[model samples]
Target chain A: MSHTTLQKKKLIARVSRLKGQMEAVERALEAERPCGEILQLLASVRGALTGLTGEVLDDHLREHVLNAEDDAARAEAVEEISEVLRTYIR
Target chain B: MSHTTLQKKKLIARVSRLKGQMEAVERALEAERPCGEILQLLASVRGALTGLTGEVLDDHLREHVLNAEDDAARAEAVEEISEVLRTYIR
Candidate 1:
Protein backbone atom coordinates (compact mmCIF):
# COMPACT_ATOMS: atom_id res chain seq x y z
CA MET A 1 0.00 0.00 0.00
CA SER A 2 0.98 3.60 -0.46
CA HIS A 3 2.31 5.50 2.50
CA THR A 4 -0.85 7.51 2.77
CA THR A 5 -2.96 4.41 2.75
CA LEU A 6 -0.75 2.82 5.34
CA GLN A 7 -0.99 5.91 7.50
CA LYS A 8 -4.74 5.97 7.25
CA LYS A 9 -4.95 2.34 8.25
CA LYS A 10 -2.68 2.85 11.18
CA LEU A 11 -4.64 5.85 12.34
CA ILE A 12 -7.96 4.10 11.98
CA ALA A 13 -6.71 1.06 13.84
CA ARG A 14 -5.27 3.13 16.63
CA VAL A 15 -8.40 5.20 17.02
CA SER A 16 -10.69 2.18 17.04
CA ARG A 17 -8.53 0.61 19.71
CA LEU A 18 -8.64 3.77 21.75
CA LYS A 19 -12.41 3.86 21.46
CA GLY A 20 -12.60 0.38 22.91
CA GLN A 21 -10.28 1.31 25.73
CA MET A 22 -12.42 4.30 26.52
CA GLU A 23 -15.54 2.14 26.54
CA ALA A 24 -13.82 -0.14 28.96
CA VAL A 25 -13.14 2.80 31.22
CA GLU A 26 -16.81 3.71 31.17
CA ARG A 27 -17.75 0.14 31.99
CA ALA A 28 -15.26 0.11 34.82
CA LEU A 29 -16.85 3.21 36.27
CA GLU A 30 -20.28 1.61 36.04
CA ALA A 31 -18.95 -1.54 37.70
CA GLU A 32 -17.34 0.42 40.52
CA ARG A 33 -13.83 -0.67 39.72
CA PRO A 34 -11.02 0.64 41.93
CA CYS A 35 -10.34 4.30 41.53
CA GLY A 36 -6.64 3.59 41.08
CA GLU A 37 -7.21 1.27 38.13
CA ILE A 38 -9.58 3.72 36.52
CA LEU A 39 -7.06 6.48 36.93
CA GLN A 40 -4.35 4.33 35.42
CA LEU A 41 -6.58 3.53 32.47
CA LEU A 42 -7.29 7.20 32.02
CA ALA A 43 -3.61 7.97 31.95
CA SER A 44 -2.92 5.21 29.46
CA VAL A 45 -5.72 6.41 27.22
CA ARG A 46 -4.34 9.92 27.34
CA GLY A 47 -0.96 8.65 26.28
CA ALA A 48 -2.48 6.71 23.43
CA LEU A 49 -4.42 9.72 22.28
CA THR A 50 -1.24 11.70 22.32
CA GLY A 51 0.55 9.12 20.25
CA LEU A 52 -2.16 9.02 17.60
CA THR A 53 -2.25 12.78 17.40
CA GLY A 54 1.49 12.89 17.01
CA GLU A 55 1.47 10.55 14.05
CA VAL A 56 -1.22 12.47 12.17
CA LEU A 57 0.37 15.81 12.93
CA ASP A 58 3.72 14.54 11.76
CA ASP A 59 2.24 13.61 8.42
CA HIS A 60 0.50 16.96 8.08
CA LEU A 61 3.64 18.92 8.74
CA ARG A 62 5.69 16.86 6.37
CA GLU A 63 3.19 16.83 3.50
CA HIS A 64 1.60 20.23 3.94
CA VAL A 65 3.55 22.59 6.18
CA LEU A 66 6.94 21.79 4.77
CA ASN A 67 6.04 21.04 1.20
CA ALA A 68 3.36 23.60 0.49
CA GLU A 69 3.93 25.69 -2.58
CA ASP A 70 3.73 29.15 -1.07
CA ASP A 71 4.22 31.12 2.10
CA ALA A 72 0.49 31.73 2.39
CA ALA A 73 -0.19 28.03 2.62
CA ARG A 74 2.51 27.62 5.23
CA ALA A 75 1.15 30.49 7.27
CA GLU A 76 -2.35 29.12 6.95
CA ALA A 77 -1.13 25.75 8.16
CA VAL A 78 0.55 27.35 11.13
CA GLU A 79 -2.56 29.30 11.99
CA GLU A 80 -4.69 26.20 11.69
CA ILE A 81 -2.34 24.46 14.05
CA SER A 82 -2.36 27.44 16.39
CA GLU A 83 -6.12 27.18 16.65
CA VAL A 84 -5.68 23.61 17.78
CA LEU A 85 -3.06 24.70 20.31
CA ARG A 86 -5.33 27.39 21.65
CA THR A 87 -8.04 24.87 22.34
CA TYR A 88 -5.79 22.91 24.67
CA ILE A 89 -4.38 25.99 26.35
CA ARG A 90 -7.72 27.63 27.09
CA MET B 1 17.31 31.28 16.78
CA SER B 2 18.25 28.05 15.10
CA HIS B 3 15.43 25.78 14.05
CA THR B 4 16.21 23.44 16.90
CA THR B 5 16.13 26.29 19.39
CA LEU B 6 12.88 27.54 17.96
CA GLN B 7 11.38 24.09 18.16
CA LYS B 8 12.39 23.69 21.79
CA LYS B 9 10.91 27.05 22.65
CA LYS B 10 7.67 26.29 20.88
CA LEU B 11 7.35 22.91 22.58
CA ILE B 12 8.05 24.37 26.00
CA ALA B 13 5.62 27.19 25.52
CA ARG B 14 2.90 24.92 24.25
CA VAL B 15 3.33 22.39 27.05
CA SER B 16 3.42 25.07 29.75
CA ARG B 17 0.24 26.58 28.37
CA LEU B 18 -1.41 23.18 28.37
CA LYS B 19 -0.41 22.69 31.97
CA GLY B 20 -2.07 25.96 32.92
CA GLN B 21 -5.22 25.01 31.04
CA MET B 22 -5.38 21.74 32.93
CA GLU B 23 -5.07 23.58 36.20
CA ALA B 24 -7.94 25.80 35.12
CA VAL B 25 -10.06 22.73 34.52
CA GLU B 26 -9.28 21.52 38.01
CA ARG B 27 -10.17 24.90 39.44
CA ALA B 28 -13.41 24.92 37.50
CA LEU B 29 -14.38 21.67 39.12
CA GLU B 30 -13.67 23.11 42.56
CA ALA B 31 -15.68 26.20 41.68
CA GLU B 32 -18.62 24.07 40.60
CA ARG B 33 -18.78 25.34 37.06
CA PRO B 34 -21.63 23.95 34.93
CA CYS B 35 -21.05 20.49 33.61
CA GLY B 36 -21.48 21.73 30.06
CA GLU B 37 -18.66 24.23 30.46
CA ILE B 38 -16.43 21.65 32.05
CA LEU B 39 -17.10 19.29 29.19
CA GLN B 40 -16.27 22.02 26.73
CA LEU B 41 -13.01 22.67 28.47
CA LEU B 42 -12.18 19.00 28.46
CA ALA B 43 -12.80 18.76 24.73
CA SER B 44 -10.73 21.86 24.07
CA VAL B 45 -7.90 20.54 26.15
CA ARG B 46 -7.95 17.29 24.24
CA GLY B 47 -7.63 19.19 20.97
CA ALA B 48 -4.72 21.20 22.24
CA LEU B 49 -2.98 18.08 23.48
CA THR B 50 -3.45 16.57 20.04
CA GLY B 51 -1.92 19.60 18.36
CA LEU B 52 1.06 19.64 20.67
CA THR B 53 1.64 15.94 20.16
CA GLY B 54 1.44 16.38 16.42
CA GLU B 55 4.06 19.10 16.39
CA VAL B 56 6.51 17.11 18.46
CA LEU B 57 5.93 13.91 16.53
CA ASP B 58 6.37 15.71 13.22
CA ASP B 59 9.68 17.08 14.35
CA HIS B 60 10.78 13.70 15.59
CA LEU B 61 9.92 12.01 12.32
CA ARG B 62 11.72 14.67 10.31
CA GLU B 63 14.80 14.96 12.46
CA HIS B 64 15.19 11.40 13.65
CA VAL B 65 13.02 8.83 11.85
CA LEU B 66 13.60 10.08 8.35
CA ASN B 67 17.17 11.03 8.97
CA ALA B 68 18.25 7.98 10.91
CA GLU B 69 21.53 6.37 9.87
CA ASP B 70 20.58 2.81 9.03
CA ASP B 71 17.94 0.13 8.75
CA ALA B 72 18.35 -1.03 12.32
CA ALA B 73 17.76 2.46 13.62
CA ARG B 74 14.69 2.82 11.44
CA ALA B 75 13.31 -0.48 12.64
CA GLU B 76 13.97 0.55 16.20
CA ALA B 77 12.11 3.80 15.62
CA VAL B 78 9.08 1.97 14.29
CA GLU B 79 9.11 -0.36 17.26
CA GLU B 80 9.38 2.59 19.61
CA ILE B 81 6.34 4.13 17.99
CA SER B 82 4.50 0.80 18.13
CA GLU B 83 5.06 0.68 21.86
CA VAL B 84 3.43 4.06 22.15
CA LEU B 85 0.51 2.88 20.06
CA ARG B 86 0.12 -0.20 22.23
CA THR B 87 -0.20 1.95 25.31
CA TYR B 88 -3.09 3.81 23.73
CA ILE B 89 -4.78 0.70 22.36
CA ARG B 90 -4.59 -1.28 25.56
Candidate 2:
Protein backbone atom coordinates (compact mmCIF):
# COMPACT_ATOMS: atom_id res chain seq x y z
CA MET A 1 0.00 0.00 0.00
CA SER A 2 1.08 3.58 -0.55
CA HIS A 3 1.87 5.84 2.31
CA THR A 4 -0.84 8.07 3.69
CA THR A 5 -1.02 11.52 2.12
CA LEU A 6 0.67 12.95 5.17
CA GLN A 7 3.48 10.50 4.83
CA LYS A 8 3.94 11.38 1.20
CA LYS A 9 4.19 15.03 2.09
CA LYS A 10 6.78 14.29 4.71
CA LEU A 11 8.76 12.23 2.26
CA ILE A 12 8.64 14.97 -0.34
CA ALA A 13 9.87 17.42 2.24
CA ARG A 14 12.77 15.15 3.00
CA VAL A 15 13.54 14.98 -0.68
CA SER A 16 13.43 18.73 -0.91
CA ARG A 17 15.92 18.97 1.88
CA LEU A 18 18.14 16.59 -0.02
CA LYS A 19 17.90 18.84 -3.04
CA GLY A 20 18.99 21.73 -0.89
CA GLN A 21 21.91 19.72 0.32
CA MET A 22 22.93 19.01 -3.25
CA GLU A 23 22.85 22.69 -3.99
CA ALA A 24 25.03 23.33 -1.00
CA VAL A 25 27.59 20.93 -2.37
CA GLU A 26 27.49 22.74 -5.64
CA ARG A 27 27.95 26.11 -3.98
CA ALA A 28 30.85 24.89 -1.96
CA LEU A 29 32.47 23.67 -5.12
CA GLU A 30 31.92 27.05 -6.81
CA ALA A 31 33.43 28.79 -3.83
CA GLU A 32 36.45 26.50 -3.91
CA ARG A 33 36.06 25.58 -0.29
CA PRO A 34 38.71 23.45 1.40
CA CYS A 35 38.53 19.75 0.61
CA GLY A 36 38.24 18.76 4.25
CA GLU A 37 35.36 21.16 4.80
CA ILE A 38 33.58 20.01 1.70
CA LEU A 39 33.94 16.43 2.79
CA GLN A 40 32.36 17.22 6.12
CA LEU A 41 29.35 18.85 4.50
CA LEU A 42 28.94 16.09 1.96
CA ALA A 43 29.06 13.52 4.70
CA SER A 44 26.33 15.36 6.57
CA VAL A 45 24.13 15.43 3.51
CA ARG A 46 24.69 11.76 2.82
CA GLY A 47 23.73 10.85 6.36
CA ALA A 48 20.45 12.71 6.05
CA LEU A 49 19.69 11.03 2.77
CA THR A 50 20.41 7.60 4.21
CA GLY A 51 18.25 8.28 7.20
CA LEU A 52 15.43 9.21 4.87
CA THR A 53 15.97 6.10 2.82
CA GLY A 54 15.92 3.91 5.91
CA GLU A 55 12.66 5.41 7.12
CA VAL A 56 10.97 4.84 3.78
CA LEU A 57 12.36 1.35 3.54
CA ASP A 58 11.14 0.46 7.02
CA ASP A 59 7.69 1.72 6.18
CA HIS A 60 7.54 -0.47 3.11
CA LEU A 61 8.63 -3.52 5.09
CA ARG A 62 6.08 -3.04 7.85
CA GLU A 63 3.22 -2.17 5.57
CA HIS A 64 3.74 -4.75 2.85
CA VAL A 65 5.94 -7.62 4.02
CA LEU A 66 5.09 -7.75 7.71
CA ASN A 67 1.34 -7.87 7.16
CA ALA A 68 1.52 -11.42 5.89
CA GLU A 69 -0.75 -13.58 8.04
CA ASP A 70 1.39 -16.65 8.62
CA ASP A 71 4.32 -17.19 10.95
CA ALA A 72 6.51 -18.49 8.16
CA ALA A 73 5.81 -15.48 6.07
CA ARG A 74 6.71 -13.09 8.86
CA ALA A 75 9.91 -14.92 9.64
CA GLU A 76 10.91 -14.89 6.02
CA ALA A 77 10.12 -11.24 5.69
CA VAL A 78 12.20 -10.44 8.73
CA GLU A 79 15.19 -12.34 7.42
CA GLU A 80 15.11 -10.70 4.02
CA ILE A 81 14.62 -7.28 5.54
CA SER A 82 17.49 -7.74 7.95
CA GLU A 83 19.82 -8.93 5.26
CA VAL A 84 18.91 -6.19 2.80
CA LEU A 85 18.92 -3.42 5.36
CA ARG A 86 22.25 -4.53 6.72
CA THR A 87 23.75 -4.68 3.28
CA TYR A 88 22.07 -1.66 1.72
CA ILE A 89 22.35 0.98 4.42
CA ARG A 90 26.09 0.77 4.74
CA MET B 1 24.21 15.72 -13.58
CA SER B 2 21.01 14.20 -14.80
CA HIS B 3 21.29 10.97 -16.68
CA THR B 4 20.68 10.81 -20.36
CA THR B 5 17.27 9.54 -21.42
CA LEU B 6 18.76 6.14 -22.06
CA GLN B 7 20.08 5.91 -18.55
CA LYS B 8 16.75 6.97 -17.14
CA LYS B 9 15.02 4.28 -19.14
CA LYS B 10 17.48 1.69 -17.92
CA LEU B 11 16.92 2.73 -14.34
CA ILE B 12 13.19 2.50 -14.87
CA ALA B 13 13.58 -0.97 -16.21
CA ARG B 14 15.45 -1.95 -13.09
CA VAL B 15 12.68 -0.43 -11.02
CA SER B 16 10.13 -2.38 -12.99
CA ARG B 17 12.00 -5.55 -12.18
CA LEU B 18 11.98 -4.60 -8.56
CA LYS B 19 8.24 -4.14 -8.82
CA GLY B 20 7.93 -7.63 -10.20
CA GLN B 21 9.99 -9.03 -7.38
CA MET B 22 7.72 -7.31 -4.87
CA GLU B 23 4.68 -8.80 -6.52
CA ALA B 24 6.26 -12.19 -6.49
CA VAL B 25 6.81 -11.88 -2.78
CA GLU B 26 3.19 -10.89 -2.34
CA ARG B 27 1.95 -13.85 -4.34
CA ALA B 28 4.05 -16.26 -2.35
CA LEU B 29 2.60 -14.88 0.85
CA GLU B 30 -0.91 -15.13 -0.53
CA ALA B 31 -0.29 -18.71 -1.60
CA GLU B 32 0.77 -19.63 1.93
CA ARG B 33 4.18 -20.81 0.89
CA PRO B 34 6.39 -22.35 3.58
CA CYS B 35 8.18 -19.77 5.71
CA GLY B 36 11.57 -21.02 4.70
CA GLU B 37 10.62 -20.80 1.06
CA ILE B 38 9.17 -17.33 1.44
CA LEU B 39 12.29 -16.20 3.29
CA GLN B 40 14.39 -17.26 0.38
CA LEU B 41 12.26 -15.30 -2.03
CA LEU B 42 12.18 -12.21 0.13
CA ALA B 43 15.90 -12.41 0.64
CA SER B 44 16.32 -12.53 -3.10
CA VAL B 45 14.13 -9.49 -3.52
CA ARG B 46 16.12 -7.61 -0.89
CA GLY B 47 19.36 -8.52 -2.58
CA ALA B 48 18.14 -7.18 -5.87
CA LEU B 49 16.94 -4.03 -4.23
CA THR B 50 20.27 -3.52 -2.54
CA GLY B 51 22.09 -4.09 -5.79
CA LEU B 52 19.99 -1.43 -7.45
CA THR B 53 20.64 0.99 -4.62
CA GLY B 54 24.34 0.42 -4.86
CA GLU B 55 24.37 1.02 -8.57
CA VAL B 56 22.57 4.33 -8.28
CA LEU B 57 24.74 5.42 -5.38
CA ASP B 58 27.90 4.66 -7.29
CA ASP B 59 26.71 6.59 -10.26
CA HIS B 60 26.03 9.66 -8.18
CA LEU B 61 29.48 9.48 -6.63
CA ARG B 62 31.17 9.28 -9.98
CA GLU B 63 29.07 11.77 -11.88
CA HIS B 64 28.61 14.43 -9.27
CA VAL B 65 30.89 14.25 -6.24
CA LEU B 66 34.07 12.81 -7.71
CA ASN B 67 34.43 15.34 -10.47
CA ALA B 68 35.57 18.13 -8.20
CA GLU B 69 38.30 20.23 -9.78
CA ASP B 70 40.91 19.75 -7.07
CA ASP B 71 42.71 16.91 -5.33
CA ALA B 72 41.56 18.03 -1.87
CA ALA B 73 37.94 18.02 -3.01
CA ARG B 74 38.39 14.54 -4.37
CA ALA B 75 39.90 13.27 -1.17
CA GLU B 76 37.08 14.71 0.93
CA ALA B 77 34.45 13.32 -1.36
CA VAL B 78 36.10 9.92 -1.23
CA GLU B 79 36.14 9.89 2.55
CA GLU B 80 32.47 10.85 2.81
CA ILE B 81 31.45 8.32 0.21
CA SER B 82 33.45 5.52 1.79
CA GLU B 83 32.00 6.24 5.19
CA VAL B 84 28.45 6.51 3.92
CA LEU B 85 28.70 3.42 1.76
CA ARG B 86 30.14 1.37 4.59
CA THR B 87 27.50 2.61 6.99
CA TYR B 88 24.57 2.36 4.62
CA ILE B 89 25.12 -1.06 3.04
CA ARG B 90 25.18 -4.27 5.01
Candidate 3:
Protein backbone atom coordinates (compact mmCIF):
# COMPACT_ATOMS: atom_id res chain seq x y z
CA MET A 1 0.00 0.00 0.00
CA SER A 2 2.79 2.40 0.74
CA HIS A 3 4.95 1.56 -2.24
CA THR A 4 5.23 -0.82 -5.12
CA THR A 5 7.46 -3.89 -4.88
CA LEU A 6 10.06 -2.29 -7.11
CA GLN A 7 10.21 0.75 -4.86
CA LYS A 8 10.77 -1.26 -1.73
CA LYS A 9 14.56 -1.33 -1.93
CA LYS A 10 14.94 2.43 -2.24
CA LEU A 11 12.37 2.99 0.46
CA ILE A 12 14.17 0.61 2.74
CA ALA A 13 17.42 2.38 1.97
CA ARG A 14 15.93 5.64 3.16
CA VAL A 15 14.72 4.05 6.36
CA SER A 16 18.12 2.51 6.83
CA ARG A 17 19.69 5.93 6.52
CA LEU A 18 17.27 7.19 9.13
CA LYS A 19 18.26 4.36 11.39
CA GLY A 20 21.87 5.37 10.91
CA GLN A 21 21.05 8.92 11.93
CA MET A 22 19.26 7.64 15.00
CA GLU A 23 22.20 5.49 15.87
CA ALA A 24 24.41 8.54 15.63
CA VAL A 25 22.15 10.29 18.07
CA GLU A 26 22.35 7.34 20.43
CA ARG A 27 26.10 7.29 20.16
CA ALA A 28 26.28 10.94 21.02
CA LEU A 29 24.14 10.36 24.06
CA GLU A 30 26.17 7.38 25.13
CA ALA A 31 29.39 9.29 24.88
CA GLU A 32 28.01 12.01 27.13
CA ARG A 33 28.73 14.55 24.47
CA PRO A 34 28.39 18.25 25.26
CA CYS A 35 24.85 19.57 25.36
CA GLY A 36 25.36 21.83 22.38
CA GLU A 37 26.86 19.10 20.24
CA ILE A 38 24.17 16.65 21.24
CA LEU A 39 21.51 19.17 20.49
CA GLN A 40 23.02 19.77 17.09
CA LEU A 41 23.10 16.06 16.38
CA LEU A 42 19.53 15.77 17.52
CA ALA A 43 18.58 18.56 15.19
CA SER A 44 20.29 16.82 12.35
CA VAL A 45 18.40 13.64 13.08
CA ARG A 46 15.18 15.60 13.34
CA GLY A 47 15.79 17.22 9.99
CA ALA A 48 16.48 13.84 8.41
CA LEU A 49 13.24 12.53 9.85
CA THR A 50 11.39 15.55 8.58
CA GLY A 51 12.74 14.97 5.12
CA LEU A 52 11.66 11.35 5.18
CA THR A 53 8.22 12.23 6.44
CA GLY A 54 7.78 14.91 3.82
CA GLU A 55 8.48 12.42 1.10
CA VAL A 56 5.78 10.10 2.32
CA LEU A 57 3.27 12.85 2.94
CA ASP A 58 3.75 14.20 -0.55
CA ASP A 59 3.05 10.73 -1.89
CA HIS A 60 -0.03 10.51 0.28
CA LEU A 61 -1.26 13.83 -1.05
CA ARG A 62 -0.88 12.64 -4.60
CA GLU A 63 -2.42 9.28 -3.92
CA HIS A 64 -5.10 10.30 -1.43
CA VAL A 65 -5.79 13.99 -1.98
CA LEU A 66 -4.47 15.66 -5.12
CA ASN A 67 -6.32 15.76 -8.43
CA ALA A 68 -4.80 16.12 -11.86
CA GLU A 69 -8.05 17.64 -13.05
CA ASP A 70 -8.26 20.44 -10.49
CA ASP A 71 -5.39 22.87 -10.20
CA ALA A 72 -7.17 25.17 -7.73
CA ALA A 73 -8.06 22.27 -5.48
CA ARG A 74 -4.48 21.10 -5.58
CA ALA A 75 -3.32 24.49 -4.35
CA GLU A 76 -5.90 24.35 -1.58
CA ALA A 77 -4.64 20.96 -0.51
CA VAL A 78 -1.13 22.38 -0.32
CA GLU A 79 -2.37 25.28 1.75
CA GLU A 80 -4.31 23.04 4.07
CA ILE A 81 -1.32 20.79 4.54
CA SER A 82 0.90 23.79 5.06
CA GLU A 83 -1.39 25.14 7.76
CA VAL A 84 -1.47 21.82 9.56
CA LEU A 85 2.30 21.57 9.38
CA ARG A 86 2.57 25.01 10.92
CA THR A 87 0.67 23.69 13.90
CA TYR A 88 1.99 20.14 14.06
CA ILE A 89 5.65 20.81 13.37
CA ARG A 90 5.71 23.42 16.05
CA MET B 1 15.89 27.59 13.87
CA SER B 2 13.56 24.64 13.41
CA HIS B 3 10.87 25.90 15.78
CA THR B 4 10.29 28.94 17.92
CA THR B 5 10.84 28.56 21.67
CA LEU B 6 7.09 28.50 22.31
CA GLN B 7 6.71 25.54 19.94
CA LYS B 8 9.43 23.48 21.59
CA LYS B 9 7.23 21.85 24.19
CA LYS B 10 4.68 20.56 21.70
CA LEU B 11 7.36 19.52 19.28
CA ILE B 12 9.04 17.61 22.07
CA ALA B 13 5.75 15.95 22.89
CA ARG B 14 5.43 14.63 19.35
CA VAL B 15 8.98 13.29 19.51
CA SER B 16 8.19 11.67 22.84
CA ARG B 17 5.30 9.83 21.28
CA LEU B 18 7.60 8.66 18.52
CA LYS B 19 10.01 7.42 21.15
CA GLY B 20 7.24 5.49 22.82
CA GLN B 21 6.29 3.91 19.54
CA MET B 22 9.89 2.95 18.96
CA GLU B 23 10.14 1.45 22.41
CA ALA B 24 7.12 -0.65 21.64
CA VAL B 25 8.87 -1.92 18.57
CA GLU B 26 11.93 -2.74 20.60
CA ARG B 27 9.89 -4.56 23.19
CA ALA B 28 8.21 -6.57 20.51
CA LEU B 29 11.57 -7.53 19.13
CA GLU B 30 12.88 -8.46 22.53
CA ALA B 31 9.92 -10.65 23.29
CA GLU B 32 10.42 -12.51 20.04
CA ARG B 33 6.83 -11.92 19.18
CA PRO B 34 5.47 -13.76 16.20
CA CYS B 35 6.80 -12.60 12.87
CA GLY B 36 3.44 -11.37 11.66
CA GLU B 37 2.78 -9.42 14.86
CA ILE B 38 6.25 -7.96 14.78
CA LEU B 39 5.81 -6.86 11.19
CA GLN B 40 2.51 -5.23 12.07
CA LEU B 41 4.14 -3.38 14.94
CA LEU B 42 6.91 -2.27 12.61
CA ALA B 43 4.34 -1.03 10.13
CA SER B 44 2.62 0.92 12.88
CA VAL B 45 5.94 2.41 13.92
CA ARG B 46 6.74 3.25 10.31
CA GLY B 47 3.42 5.00 9.96
CA ALA B 48 4.03 6.98 13.10
CA LEU B 49 7.46 7.98 11.83
CA THR B 50 5.99 9.01 8.50
CA GLY B 51 3.44 11.13 10.28
CA LEU B 52 6.13 12.86 12.32
CA THR B 53 8.36 13.42 9.35
CA GLY B 54 5.50 14.85 7.30
CA GLU B 55 4.80 17.49 9.93
CA VAL B 56 8.33 18.85 10.03
CA LEU B 57 8.68 18.73 6.26
CA ASP B 58 5.59 20.87 5.97
CA ASP B 59 7.14 23.39 8.31
CA HIS B 60 10.35 23.43 6.30
CA LEU B 61 8.48 24.05 3.08
CA ARG B 62 6.67 27.01 4.55
CA GLU B 63 9.79 28.34 6.18
CA HIS B 64 12.19 27.62 3.35
CA VAL B 65 10.12 27.42 0.16
CA LEU B 66 6.46 28.48 0.06
CA ASN B 67 5.34 32.06 -0.61
CA ALA B 68 2.22 34.01 0.27
CA GLU B 69 3.04 36.47 -2.50
CA ASP B 70 2.78 33.97 -5.32
CA ASP B 71 0.10 31.32 -5.66
CA ALA B 72 1.50 29.92 -8.88
CA ALA B 73 4.93 29.40 -7.41
CA ARG B 74 3.32 27.87 -4.33
CA ALA B 75 1.52 25.32 -6.46
CA GLU B 76 4.69 24.61 -8.36
CA ALA B 77 6.41 23.87 -5.09
CA VAL B 78 3.66 21.44 -4.25
CA GLU B 79 3.94 19.72 -7.60
CA GLU B 80 7.71 19.53 -7.39
CA ILE B 81 7.47 18.11 -3.92
CA SER B 82 4.87 15.65 -5.12
CA GLU B 83 7.15 14.42 -7.86
CA VAL B 84 10.01 13.91 -5.45
CA LEU B 85 7.73 12.06 -3.10
CA ARG B 86 6.63 9.83 -5.89
CA THR B 87 10.24 8.93 -6.38
CA TYR B 88 11.28 8.89 -2.74
CA ILE B 89 8.26 7.30 -1.12
CA ARG B 90 8.32 4.48 -3.58
Q: Candidate 1, residues A1-90: lDDT per residue as tens digits? A: 222344544544554566566566556545555333444555566777666555545654665577766898777666655555565455
lDDT of 1 by residue, B8-76 (tens): 445445545655565565555455553334344555657776665445445545544677667876676
Best by TM-score: 1
TM-score of each: 0.47, 0.43, 0.41
> Predictions ranked by lDDT, top down?
2, 1, 3
lDDT of each: 0.54, 0.55, 0.50
Arranged by DockQ with the best first, the candidates are 2, 3, 1
Show the colliding residue pairs in model 3.
none
Q: Which prediction has the highest lDDT against the true structure?
A: 2
Alpha-carbon error at A58 in model 1, in Å?
A: 2.1
Estimate the Cα RMSD of every predicted model relative to the unseen true structure.
Answer: 16.6, 9.8, 14.4
Pairwise DockQ winner, candidates 1 and 3: 3
Better of 1 and 2 by DockQ: 2
